[model samples]
Target: MNKHFYQKCIASALALIMFFSLFAGANPAKAEAALNINADGAILVDGETGKVLYEKNADSVLGIASMTKMMTEYILLDAVKKGKVKWDQEYTPSDLVYKISQNRDLSNVPLRADGKYNVRELYDAMAIYSANAATIAIAEIIGGSETNFVKMMNEKAGKLGLKDFKFVNSSGLNNRDYKGEQPQGTGAEDENVMSARAVAKLAFHLINDFPDVLKTASTPKKTFREGTEDRIEMINWNWMLPELDYGYQGMDGLKTGTTDFAGYCFTGTAGRDGKRFITVVQNAKDSSGKGGYKARFDETRKMMDYAFSNYSKEKIVPKHYQVKGQKTIPVIKGKENEVKIYTKSAINMIVHNGDEKNYQPVLVLDKKKINKDGKLTAPIKKGEKVGYVTVKPKNGEKVSFLTGEDQIQVDVIAAQDVEKANWFVLMMRGVGNFFGDVWHGIASTVKGWFK
Candidate 1:
C-alpha cells in the first residue's frame, strides 16, 4: 500500500479501538441491596474506614432511649483523659438522683444522696446496667448539674458533626419537661433524639477515641463498687455478647436501648481477622408478634452475620509499596537529581466476598504535581504530603458495585527525608546534567536523521 493509504488505515483502526474502550469503561454498576433489616432506622459502617455499608432511614432523628448513654460515656471518658476526673474521683448525688433511683418506673443504681461514688463505679453502672440515676450523677459531676451536663452533651454532638440530634438530658430517660431544647413539664416526654447515622458516627468516635469503653462494655457481668457495702451487681443488657444465648463469636460490648416509644434499639460492634464492623438498629420488632428487645438482638445478628460473612479487609495499597512504572521524580538543588518514592501508609479497603477478586482499584496521580521534567523541590520531609492518589474503580461499572461512589483520596507523601543540596554539590550536578542533556539531544537528532 502507498504510505498515505497505510497511515489512513492505521488512523481509522485506532479511532475504532478508542471508541470501544470508552464505551466499555463508562457504564457504572448499580449497587444491589445486600441486607433487609427490620427497623425504622438502621446503619452499618466499616469500623476502620467509616464507610457506610448499609443504611435505612439513618438520618431520621427520633428518641434513642438508653443508647444516649454512649454519648455520656464519650463525655465521661474524655473527662478522665483530660484529668478532669479520676477513676477514684467521687461525686455527691443530689435529691434528684435519689428521686430517680427510688422512682421504680426508671432504671437506676441505688444512690445515697449523702453517699459519694467514684467515677469508675458510676461509669460501670451506666455502661453495663444503663442505670439512669448513675448517669445523672456522673453528668452532674462533669457539668456541675444535669441541665449543664445536657448542654455539654449537645456541644459534644455538635463537635462530632452529628446532625438531626438533640440532647435534652445526659441520660436517655424521657423527661416530660424537655422537647428539642424546649422544656414543657416534668413528665416522661422529654428525651434525647438522634438519627441512626448520628448514633453510628458517635459510636465510631467513641471507639476510635476511648477504646477503653469496650473493656467495660464487653463484660457480660461485673460488680460495681467492688469490696464495698454499696457494691451492686451489674448485668450487661447486650444479648449479643458471646455468653448470651443470642451471642456470636467476636461480638463485644456496646449499648442497647428499649422504651415504649423507641421500641427496641441497639448499637453493636464485632471484629474478625482485624476487620471490625459497627451496626445500629432502632424501633425493631420481633418475629413472635412481640414488641420487646428480642427483635433488636435478632436483627442485629442478621446484619452482623451478613457483614462478617460477606466482607473482608483488603490492603489495596500496601505501605512502602513502590509506585510501579513511575519515573523517578527529579529533585531541585539536592544531592541527587532524582529520588524514589513509596506509599507512606497502607490503603486498606473493606470489600464484600467475591469482590476481593473482582474489584480493582486504580491509582490516579495529580498531573500538576508531576511536571514534564519530573522535578520536585528538595528538603522534602518524610510523611509530608506531596500529592494525592485517588483510589477509584478500575472499571467504571464497578463504581455502583462499591459501597460509595466517591473515590478514596490517599495523601502521597515523601517516604524519606531529602536534605537540601550544598552549593558545591549543586554546581557539580548542574554541570553534569547540562552535558548529559546536550549529549542526549545530539544523539536523538542523529538517530532520527538516520531513521
Candidate 2:
C-alpha cells in the first residue's frame, strides 16, 4: 500500500469520527463536584469575564444588609470621579447621621456633630468600617438628601440591569429605629433587598469601573489624620487580607456585610497569576455563634479555592490568530492570486484546568458563497465576513469549552482587498486550470488502475 493512500485513509477515518462526535456528545473531564457551602445564597464568578463558576440559590431574594453600601459607594464614587463632588470638601453630619453613628446596634465610625469630616474621610470610613452614618452623610452630600440618594441608588441598579434588587436606604441597616428625613417617596418598612447574584454583579461593576475601591477596601487598617490631636484610626473587617493569612495570597479588598436579617454576607475578590475572581456568600449562618464571621469567610475561601484550583482563563480564538488551514482564498478575476482572511474579533473562554487540549477548532468554509470551482470572484473587500471557525469539544456538545453549553463559533473574515483580474489574465488562468484538472484526473486514473 502506498504511504500517501494510508495517510489519506487515516485522515478520512478521523474526519468521520469527528462528525459523529459532534452529535454523539462529549464527555469532558469532570472536576471534583462543587463543594456545598453553608449559605442561603452564594455565587462565584470570574472577575475578568463575568463567568459564573459556582452558584447556589444565587437568585433568591433576601435582605442584603451592608452589601447595599456597595451601591452607595458606586454612586458616590462615580459622582466624585465625575467632579460632581470633592474629596477635600467637608460636610457636617446631620443629627440623624450622628445618631446612627452613635447607635450601639449598628456598625459605625463614630462621627460627631462637631467633627468636620471631608468627603474622602467619610467614604473611607463607610467602605472600610461599614459605617452607616458616614454612608448616609455621603449620600446627603452627593444626592442632596438621603431620599434622593436612595432613588439614585435604585436608578443605578436599573442601569446595571440588576434583576433582583431594591434599595430603600443608603445604609443596609433596618429603618425602624432610625428617625431622620426619609426620602420623600420612601417609608420605614422599606429595606435593601437583593440576591447573591445581584450583589455579585454589583461587586463586579464596582471593581471593574472603580478599581480604586479595591485600594480602600483592601487596607487592613488606616488612620485618617495620623499623629494629629483629632486623629481617627479605622480597621478593615475583611479577614482574607494578607495581614491575617499571608498564605491566602492575592486576597484583596472587598466589602463584608452582616445584620440580624441579612445574616453574614461577603463580596470577596482575589487574584493569582493574573486571574481574578469575585465571590458572594449571603445568609451564611453561624452554626456556632462564636464562628459567625469565620463561617462566611470559610465559605468564600472554599469557593475561591475550588475556582482557582479547577479553572483558568483561556483564549477561545486569540486576537492575532491566523486561519491555520487556509490563509488565502483563490480569486477568479482579481489581480492578486489570493486574498488573506481571518477572524474579526478575539474570543475568550474560561476553561477547566487540563481540558484545554480537548477543544478542537474546526474551520467550516462557505464553499457555496465563496468558491464553486476553487476560485472566488473578485473584487473582494477587506474584513468581509466569509465563514465560521467553530470551536467544539472532541467528545461533543456536552463538554464544550464555552460554559459547557454552547460551542464557540467565531466569524471568519477577509483580511485584505483583492482587485478584479483583467480579461486576458482570466482567459489564460481558465485554460491552465482546465488542462491542470485533466492531467490530475488522468494521473488519479492511472494510480487507481495500479491499486
Query: Each model's TM-score, in the order given?
Result: 0.79, 0.74
lDDT of 2 by residue, 319-365 (tens): 54566767777776889978887777776666677666667766677
Per-model CA lDDT versus the true structure: 0.76, 0.79
Model 1 deviation from the true structure expressed as Cα RMSD, one decimal place: 8.5
Model 1, 208-304: lDDT tens digits are: 8888788988989888778978777877899889997678788886999887777888999988888888889999877654656788888888888
Instruction: Count clashing residue pairs per candidate.
Output: 6, 5
Off by over 4 Å in 1: 1-34, 177-188, 225-231, 287-290, 324-327, 357-375, 381-385, 388-390, 396-411, 415-451
Pairs of residues clashing in candidate 2: 26-395, 26-396, 147-183, 333-421, 334-421
